[model samples]
Target: MPQWSEYTDGERIKILRGMETRQSDLAEMTGLSLQTIQQAEQGKRLTLRTLIRIADALGVDTSVVLGQQAPRRSMQRDDRAMVRDLSRTVHDTAAGLLDITDPPALEELREASKACWDTYWRGSYMEAGALARPLLEQAAARLHDQPADEQAEAWGLLADAYRLAAYVANLIGSRDLAYAAIGHAQHAAEQAADDVRRALVMSGRSWVYLRDTRLADALTLAERAATDIEPKFSTATMEQLVAYGSHVNFAAVVASRMEDKERAADYLSQSHATGARMGQEYRAHGTVFGPVSATTQAVGINVALGETGKALSLIGDIKPVHERVLSGAARNRYAMDKALAQADAKLWDASLETLEGALLAAPQWARHQVLPSVIVSRVATGSTTRLRRVVELIGTASSTGGFPPATPRNAL
Candidate 1:
């Protein structure tokens, strides 16, 4: 079989639509004309907006339709395995079927949960999934064995473990497992009776919705979560500020995706204010928020809204020290946004260089992101050699038949 990247954009759309979804059905679903759908499938006059609408209607990322990434059913073998193990762990633990004879102590489970989150933020998603299975089993076992007084902490740990599982599943394109894991996380959070944890679980669920192209649902839930944890700043603890800040920033993200510039700006202002009050980066409940995060995230928001000049300006405002403070995954994400802005502005060489550097810095994480491929596809005129190199880095080289070998997690 030919690699996905070998197909024309139109062919990809037709294949993704499958026999069950007629062109008229897709047209209605996307609120586009049937002629538009037919033209898009024939690789004629398919605008970016139309492509995004089609992809959303099809329940896949634009990268999948662009042939830069495979659809969920065609995910790589290792990705499938990781999702499989995570699915089993999520379901088995929720059903009380795990036979964990010797669960780790509560403190040990807490530390393990932190380690799993650390691995995930480091962009070692496969490793994170591997770590999450045992963490979930151990946390569930501890929850079952702990007495009433200690049960809350165990439940909290289990919620954290499930959050990690959800994150991994979402990134790996296992949407069903992502929803299941986050549902279990929310249940555990509720059992713990921790308002902040519940709010964070809502934030996680909103993220799943965002990736699933349920924009309105994502925006609603993010706004609600932010409101639930809104801090007074005068007396609020660091945890409250971080949680609230993360939610507002995520709201900005969802709002931007929806092209609601006014609402996006409003949420961004709140995020910036929350970050300013916090004074520095704070990580809690598996989320990060701070001045650096707020600013870096804004670059992408602006880029999404077609404000390339604003995005470039924001990128310029980022200090070297601030950039250094971001995690591997966060840093790569920022790089992709910067490269995208540069591409939009026709700074082809700079865009390619930025993309190349990011891909080398964290190939594992870069592969999971759609932005790298999006950036490459937008650069229509560049040094063929350099463009080819960027293509190879993103694993879309037709010569390779598919993506390159997976980068070892330890390399990052």
Candidate 2:
């Protein structure tokens, strides 16, 4: 099979412009013409190897083009780089695990994060701190010894990494860890008073809150951060693009969580406006702004809030938007919301169907914890089996938590 490197510049350019271009985007920093880059993507008649030049120019390792790496260039990617690469791998792996909704992918992703964490430590932990508490912690240490003037950049990286970690952790039933990291990110960003860092920490964690409509602290912080950062960041820098879009999406999700349908709709409209402003898409890089419809978030919120008919109507309007790069786990999370909405409608059949789909979509990621805490109050004694599975999964992830299915079905 022809590798991406073998493609002419044209084909490479096409992929570069895709949603999965975390690495490819860096390639464009080479100052090459669009036609030449496009030709390199297609492996057409070009004596000049733009991909290599592109990679070199951007200070990135070429393997990022092949999907084996996340970013091609590293600012100081040693252990920090390892942690980041592993964290992203962990995020995507968790998603894959969730999509399978089984132990295999969950086990695999869990193991991968563990392995990377171990490798990262042996390579750099002693140099940074006594332990590898989380990726965010490591990122923060880089700033501790730096001069006050030079520490802002490190702080920004720390805040972003922590928020990203928290977002991923919450999806995998690691809520406490998620919150902890976000808190650390919040503190670090505040200390730095860095607009980009503060914006990232707030908006990133808020994205998780948007899921349950519970992470409002995240959105609130993001909005404030956006306001602070707006004057500091020009439209030319990617930071402005990221910070602005984050607030738009945060507002949409926060409104949904609050059950203010009108507000959610308005915020989503604002988010789309910002989306149009982005020169390129992140390729499912739901990190900045996402495909999350106000309708989808609202439907889930209404279901959680006991407005079943409203939830159903909103869900019906959802356009079946799915992302290729958002991670299987995150996708499964959306499915869980859909199921919960069905359950609220007392469409027991619909609810059961939704649950079944959620199971099939993310058996492992769907552990008992994913169920709404409020569901327990609404559901009868007979439906506890489904609840038990979720409980057991949470226990597994917990350094302190597990559940014994009341009826002991070996579903795994």
Candidate 3:
């Protein structure tokens, strides 16, 4: 049996499309000609634009179609279980199904919510999900028990918990649960009437849309959120700056995914300007944005736009002092983009080395990401031993082994 990485681009597309979706169906979905769809499945003249459209129509990330990622159904059993448990917690709490007589005080819930966000940024998503289960239940119970005077704070805490839950679900490929959690988070934010929190919730939803391949919706929501909270740079509060910067940065992300280089560049410029005004990285309302973040994220945005040289150039701009402020997940994401850029530049050995270092530094987080495998599969020439080590760390060799077969679906 060949590995998924061994499949050609066309074969991978066919597999992802499955028997349920005929070529004509795909053609209609992608707005491409039948000839184009047939050529795509035959490994003939498949352009990037066509590939993006097909991947979008298939409802999976481009990496999955490129064989860099197994479909979500190939997710590890433990990860599936974690998402299931998280989903149950999110739904049960929303329905007021939990039985809790002694809810913690607002301060305690605040601390726990902060801890969950911290865990998530540290790239310990599973641990964060575990923490969120109890936190959501408790936050919901606390919201119910709080007096009228204190209810706003309680609602804010609950919104934060739901945002955390949404993050975990989005990263782990539970799209429906991610949507549900964010929807609940938005409602809670509205209840609290915190403009900053409400804007941040919109940002979170944009992320979920991005991951789910609703690029237009994601870009629109992010742009709207940023516009709504656009603060006066001369006197904006730090919280306001962070919220605005995060949304614009995310809009840049979604635009890049849409391959709208012009819009992406504009958003990236706004993000960098905002970050410079802030002068430092600040994490708040479950989002991070600042000088370090703007610079680090540009590396990925450039790569997505096929500007590998530009991406590689930005890597040098990230000074060691600034890099030190990035979260573990943020750091690894930068490394992945850097490696991809290196591979695109034909520096195969350097790409493999960069990927190996990230895998060694954050093996668990690496396992959950598709980019490591994408980098490994793209490197045409490198130390075989080093490449295998990176592959092993990302668990691509066993991507489907020991897991029950997933039912074939027409779309993700």
Better of 1 and 2 by TM-score: 1
lDDT of 2 by residue, 247-326 (tens): 66566556655667776666666555555555443421124333343234445555544577876786676555433333
Question: What TM-score, computed on C-alpha atoms, does each candidate reach?
Answer: 0.80, 0.48, 0.79
For each candidate in the order shown, give its overall lDDT on alpha carbons.
Answer: 0.84, 0.48, 0.83
TM-score, candidate 3, is 0.79
**Ranked candidates (lDDT, high to low):** 1, 3, 2
Clash totals in order:
0, 35, 0
Model 1 spans with C-alpha error above 4 angstroms: 1-76, 396-412
Q: Give the per-residue lDDT digits (tens) of candidate 1, residues 1-412.
A: 6676888999888877765668999899999999999999899878999999987777666887887767653244345456667788899999999798888898788788888888888888888998999999999999999997879989999999998899888876677899999999999999999999999999999999988888899999999999998989899898999899989999999999989999999999999998899899988878877889999999999999999999999988998799988877788889989999999999999999999998888866766666777788889888888898988776642212123332222110
Full-model lDDT, candidate 3 = 0.83
Candidate 2 stretches with Cα past 4 Å from truth are 1-141, 144-149, 164-183, 190-193, 203-223, 226-242, 256-262, 275-288, 292-295, 302-314, 317-325, 372-412
lDDT of 3 by residue, 1-412 (tens): 5666778899878877765578999899999999999999999878999999998777666886787866664444345446667888999999989799999998888788888888999999878988898999999999998887889999999999999999988877677889999999999999999998998999899988888778789889999999999999999988899999988988998898889999999999999999999999998877777888999999999999999878988997877777789998899888898999999998998999988888788877865676776787789988889877777776642253232223232121
